[model samples]
Target: MPQGPNGYDLTVMHPFRGARYKDSVATNGRYWAGPLTHFAINTATYLFTYHFFANYSTEYPDGFLSEQTLKSFEGVSGERGSFKWKHGAERIPENWYRRQPGNDYGILNFALDAVGALQALPYMAVIGGNTGEPNTFTGVNIADLTGGVFNAATLLEGNNAMCFAFQAVHSAAPDILKGLLGNVVLAVSKLTDALDPILAQLGCPQMAKYDKSLLAKFPGAGAGL
Candidate 1:
């Protein structure tokens, strides 16, 4: 089923048998196509997710929380819940959650490709089918195809792990920043409370208010007042 001098032979590339023939040029190429495509997709996702989280972490280390910690305060109480929503996803410019499905898919694909790549080598060895010669015009030799699959699997796993890690970090960034800001405001309020006595002795107006409403917003800000 080799092609004509100027055109591809459809019989050689038939959907059912294109990848089954040992000597056909399309065999090895088609056999490895699925894993290769998965590898490429995971690699691209890893790069994008890694850079996003890396840049974000570098730019805001103090405000970066782990996903677990972010979730801890998500629906705990009224103020914390409002804080999470108001200063977190609601205010952040980017849609971090939108990319989650892609990352999830990448992880699943990585698992499938890893298993496929591992099985491919053993399957080829057991099948005992001749991979033909090493001529460039025909197709790749068995050794080259096996090596390529191994390398692609290794890279795919590594990239998939990186993508998962970065995605977690990116997803929690907004909540972490919100918490940091809330703590800063709380600290400032406490400092103002500490200076109340000094202002009273100097006959100056006190800036710190122990009002119930304000204390409710910055809980523990009026502890000593």
Candidate 2:
């Protein structure tokens, strides 16, 4: 059922009961980066239609959205966001965003990077040179670091996952995609593990949701984040 880093579970069911979260997310009304519209008219028409029926779109109540790049903005929870689902005890929307949004994405959560890969993933190495770019989920640009900027040492050194799972997916080989997904899950867990104490240190209980136990089931991705 699990596929892709953001818990792209294929077994996801219908509107209200089984897959209600995704359905709700479809209506969440926030514009994410990089969704392709067939044409400007099509895009405008969709937006117009959405806005026109904003109050009553059966598919989405909040509205349609795409995804965001990681490590692009500053002050972001460094915690990934989550799926709209209400599943396991740990599976909660707030908790997922507390971890890495694109990495080991909690079940049914989606944050696909532009072009479905981290062609230019965003991240930082504060201990080294301080790229000086703020990090966040949306409006991020490519991070030339272009490789793994992870591990306990990296964490202590002030390095950010930056690209999150989008990096793993892009950096992987064609045959290694599936394994890369697992790695993304591991990375999300790792980031969450790293994020928890830091948030606690900062006295932000609001950020606790991004902790490890919540996002235990990272999916296997065949596609993008």
lDDT of each: 0.30, 0.26
The residue ranges of model 1 lying beyond 4 angstroms of the native Cα positions read 1-35, 54-225
Candidate with best TM-score: 1
- For 128-202, candidate 2 gives per-residue lDDT tens digits of 111122221222221222223333233222112222322333333233444556675566566567555543443
lDDT of 2: 0.26
Summed over model 1, clashes come to 0
TM-score for model 2? Answer: 0.15
* lDDT of candidate 1 over 1-225, digit per residue (tens): 233221221221232232333343333322221222222333333333222332123343322332333333343224433544433332222322222323333434444443343344332211111123221222122223232222323423433322222322232334335556767556655554654443343332211211222212222112211
Candidate 2 Cα misplacement greater than 4 A, ranges: 1-60, 63-148, 151-162, 174-225
TM-score of each: 0.18, 0.15
